[model samples]
Target: MSKRVASSTDDVASSKKAKIQDDDDDDSAYLEEHKIVVEGGDARPIRDFGAFNEKARHQLEAAFAAPTPTQAISWALALRGSDVISIAKTGSGKTLGFLLPAFHKMEQKTVRGACSPQVLVLAPTRELATQIGVEAAKFAPAFAVRTATVFGGAPKWEQNHQLKILGGRGCVVGTPGRVNDFLDSNKIQFSLLETLVLDEADRMLDMGFEPQIRSIVAKISRPTQTLLYSATWDNKVQKVAATLLRNPVKFVLGDAGTKLVANKDIAQTVEVLDESKKTARAVEFVAAREAAKLIVFVATKRGCDALCRDLRRTTKCDALHGDKDQHERNRVIDKFRKSKKGVLVATDVAARGLDINDVTHVLCYDFPKGTHGVEDYIHRIGRTGRAGNKGRSHVFVTPQDSNLPALVRILQDADQPVPDDLKQLAFTRRSGGRGRGYSRGRGGSSSYGFRGRGSSSYYGSRPTGRFSSSSSSSSSGTKIRF
Candidate 1:
């Protein structure tokens, strides 16, 4: 699929007006294209908050003329002081969903006393926490609302200074460790917090921050609004919700809160190659396509470095992983976001919440590991194909990796096209395995049981690829078409 550039200025103006007018009758018309419908009950668009503090409403309107689906649901449910678990796709305005409620609660308290921040937001990465801080500022500017971000790799003294300035008067957004540190030191009082938000809860759990999360939550008083938001809600989230929330209102934004579906605007393709040859194939593919703004996801941090070195010898590329210093990682992300043609080789650390929306292509250098890994997969590919724009994702699969079948099944079930070669590879892996509970491919069967063979279920489907290499040169960089 060809990429769709934004229309001319006049065209954009006309469309915006049409959407605003449609807002009264049925805002769904403007959002229907992006809506993900589920069974059992139809999900309605989020309702407006009439009783909210005017300052909070103004901020929400400025950030988005109309609230996004996640934002709407969160505002309605969370502002009512309900515990919520929000499951939504990345870049679908999930941040604002929680932020709006936090802002309203803060504003309400401000009316009684000089705003003592009663909200705590925990994010998986410093970058994400910083992003949330920025959003929170935009959402509650009226209440002298300040957001103090606490993360590692920065000087502790500087963070302490920020906390001292906060003085229990503004929101505290930070990683679990730093937040816990502040709580232990009595620099921040968790008991005063009226809301606790666990952003990217699944990622935090995977990072072994569960102990810290529980510790921090234990510090906060009861009757606090607990909001958990993630791209996917697997067993871990359910377990946490059961323990933390009291009759929570669960909001699954897209496709019943399973693995985030591949963005419909993206055209995905898979290339089957030997494990040893995957890197070579990737370099060849990138060199052949002259892809601008590329991101490659590898499984390990060491793999990220090696791939960057290899790609850098032939083409300019940068590497990002957990190993890099936070400042350096932030610099690389900024540079990549601005560069016209550059590639960033990364691990899952860069996958969850780093928003580099201009990425033109996502190349999966390694297959993701499990269900949570699949959430990372969607986030990686979702770097491209944003805001109704078209993008491409190419997955490099090997015969030895038996997980390809389940991956293909997930994509197909999500309405994405699975290449013919991928289907052939799945059949080969299933039959070739030595009595490993593999079944013959059933023709025209939507539901095939391929469970426990790999990590996830093979949902409904059998699905139905070629390559060419060519190169062209442009001023920004060389162009390769494949």
Candidate 2:
């Protein structure tokens, strides 16, 4: 809302460049395990939650099974910088990483300033903000501290009452847009804010909320403690971490369950299909699973609606997207989650914060594109195969995807084999505004990784020939006409 940026202490800004270097940096992608070290700081281990404030201990155990590696590292190195940047796997208990610290810091404050809160937690999506608020609610009662959540798609009156009327205090978890709305109207201020956290920060950047986040942080009265978290260290994330954190500590933990690099438990495969026949292919896959919970990702809200409608005839299916009201979105998600087995078609919005475990399949009905490249592909597939469980992902690719080259490089770097056909698509350039049709594979209908169990190959040896999808999963080869 405010164009002004958060003021930084000159002393802190000057010392930012001379950060302690990580010399013994034995950072490995896989295999050899290493502990976390922050900016030359010694590798730290997770401490016991037993020593936390009496109320804090109760909430910590209630909210999580136990402190995750990221949460532990975050709390372990909490004081290294006024800001800390933690990147860890999704669903690995990232919420408490900042929440615990913020509440703990609040416990020490003796004075309450007018219109200024002690802490601010910013999230990219309402669902995420609401989720944080729920966790905060569960924990704050033990400490007698108040928490408020502000987001769109809800009555602003109640949120306003919580902040303006009752006096926002203890903690506030909210989406950037709604937070900006309040900040712009001068109803809220961060003068007393001691700690600020950006959760799921990469998603905020992808959603283009950088300007709002900057404006919100810049207005903090003093050098506020900041914590930034995300699943990947893409360039945008790195840049923000550099600008916002002062001599910060960085902890990069591979995915939670396996403790190896991310996405190890999930087997991924892709099908290059014609646009007209893509829906048929997707249905075939879902029908094959029968009762498994399936999440089909589409590119547009309209696509989500259309595909969900088509799939409804075969089985009960639902859709989720920004276009749907928050009430409807919640209902759809709850219904799908409770059904034990159902289909949900959605845009990339569901890629993050819509935590529905037990999802057996993540189908990319429409492939990722533009800024939402391989990074997003990872998040979408991440929904399934979580908490040590195994899952499968199927991506549908078409010639229209300019993202093919990047996907090829990503797969190659990860040691996953490049689909033989995808390699050609990645290397070729558009010729005279015309692209080549998908090469026909010889024998089997394209089903990913059906050969055996516990396979990690992403492309599954590429279909030998072009084949159509069939109503039956065991069909030898289903053929389709162009």
Best by TM-score: 2
Judge candidate 1 against the unseen true structure and give its global Cα lDDT, from 0 to 1. Answer: 0.68
Candidate 1 lDDT trough over 10 residues, lowest sum? 457-466
Looking at model 1, residue 389 earns an lDDT score of: 56
Off by over 4 Å in 2: 1-37, 51-65, 79-82, 108-115, 164-169, 232-239, 254-262, 334-340, 387-389, 412-418, 429-482
Give Cα-based local distance difference scores for all models: 0.68, 0.68
Q: What is candidate 2's TM-score against the reference? A: 0.75
Model 2 RMSD in angstroms: 12.0
Question: In model 1, which regions exceed 4 Å deviation?
Answer: 1-65, 111-116, 137-143, 167-169, 258-260, 287-291, 338-341, 370-375, 386-389, 432-482
Ten residues in a row with the worst lDDT in model 2? 455-464
Using Cα atoms with residue i matched to residue i, what is each candidate's TM-score against the true structure?
A: 0.74, 0.75
Candidate 2: C-alpha lDDT: 0.68
